[model samples]
Target: DAMVIQNPRYQVTQFGKPVTLSCSQTLNHNVMYWYQQKSSQAPKLLFHYYDKDFNNEADTPDNFQSRRPNTSFCFLDIRSPGLGDAAMYLCATSRDVTAQYNEQFFGPGTRLTVL
Candidate 1:
C-alpha cells in the first residue's frame, strides 16, 4: 500500500534532550505537513514542505524544526523535549494547494513521551 508512514509509534525521551520523528510517503505528494496535536486541543500546524519551499507557521515555537530531504520524506526535530511537549505528532500529505481545496492523508501519529 502506498501511504504515509511514521516510524517509532512510541518514543520516550528525557527532558531537554533532542528527539527526531520521521515521516515518509509513497504517494509522492508535493506537499507534506507536520502537526502537533495535544490531548484535547486542536491540531496545530507546525510546518510544511511545498515541493522545495519550506513553510513554518508563525506561531510555531523555536523548539520545533523540520527537514525534508526529498519529496517522499520529512523529519521533525525537537531541539529540547519538555514535559509540556509530550503529544501526538501527525504527518500529512497533499498534492497541491488550490482555491477550492484538496484532501490530505494523515499517518497514524507518533506519540512522544517526555520524562
Candidate 2:
C-alpha cells in the first residue's frame, strides 16, 4: 500500500536548457516506468526499470534519459529542453513485470513547460 511521489509538481525551463524531473516510491515495486504525456494525447512509454535493468522504448528520443540509482527513486533528465518537449512526465510502479493484474501506482506527475 505504498505510494509514488514526484517533486516540483510544475517546472519551467528556457529553450535548449537542461531539466530534470524526479520521482520516488515507497512501494518497493520491482518495476518502475516513465511516461510522457502531451495535451490531448495518450501517455507514451519512455522507459522502465525492472529491478536494476533498464528498458527504453524503441521510439524514445535520445534527449530523454532516466536513472534509477536505487529501488525507490528514479530520475528523468532532459538534456536539452525544446518547445515540443513540454508535457506531463509520469512515474509509475508495479510489483513486477509478470504480475497477474499488472496493477500500477502512478505519481501526480511533473508538468514541464519550455519557454
Candidate 3:
C-alpha cells in the first residue's frame, strides 16, 4: 500500500547528543510534514515540505531541523537532545492540506527517549 513509514520506531539519545529520525512514503504526495507530540499535549507542527519548498513553523525551536532530499524521503535532525525533548515524532503526507478537500495521512511515528 502507498503509505508513510518511519524507521526505528523507538530511539534513545543522550543529553546534548544529536539524533536523526527518518521517514519515507510511497504516496507521492506533494506535502510532507513533521510534528512533535508530548504526553497529554497535542501534536505540534515543526516543519513541512511542499514539493521542494521547506516551511518551518514559527514556534519550532532551533534544536529541531529537517531535510527532504527527495519526494519519497524526509529526515528530522535534533541538534541537541534534551531530557524535555523526549517525545513522539510523526511524519505525515498530504496532497494539499490547505485545499478545501485535502487531508493528511500520518506514519506510526518515532518515539524518542532522552537519557
The digit string of per-residue lDDT tens for model 1 on 1-115 reads: 9999999899999999999999999998899999999996898999999998999999989999999999999999999998999999999999887634458889999999999
TM-scores, all candidates, are 0.95, 0.96, 0.95
What does candidate 2's lDDT look like per residue over 1-115, in tens digits? 6799998899999999999899999988999999999996999999999999999999999999999999999999999989999999999999988868479889999999999
What 10-residue stretch in candidate 2 is worst by lDDT? 96-105
Tens-digit lDDT track for model 3 on 1-115?
9899999899999999999999999998989999999985899999999999999999899999999999999999999999989999999999876776269899999999999
RMSD of each predicted structure: 1.1, 1.0, 1.1
Give the residue spans of candidate 2 off by over 4 A: none
Pairs clashing in candidate 2? none
Which regions of candidate 1 deviate over 4 angstroms? 99-101
CA-lDDT, candidates in order: 0.94, 0.94, 0.94
The TM-score between candidate 2 and the true structure equals 0.96
Q: Rank the candidates by lDDT, best first.
A: 2, 3, 1
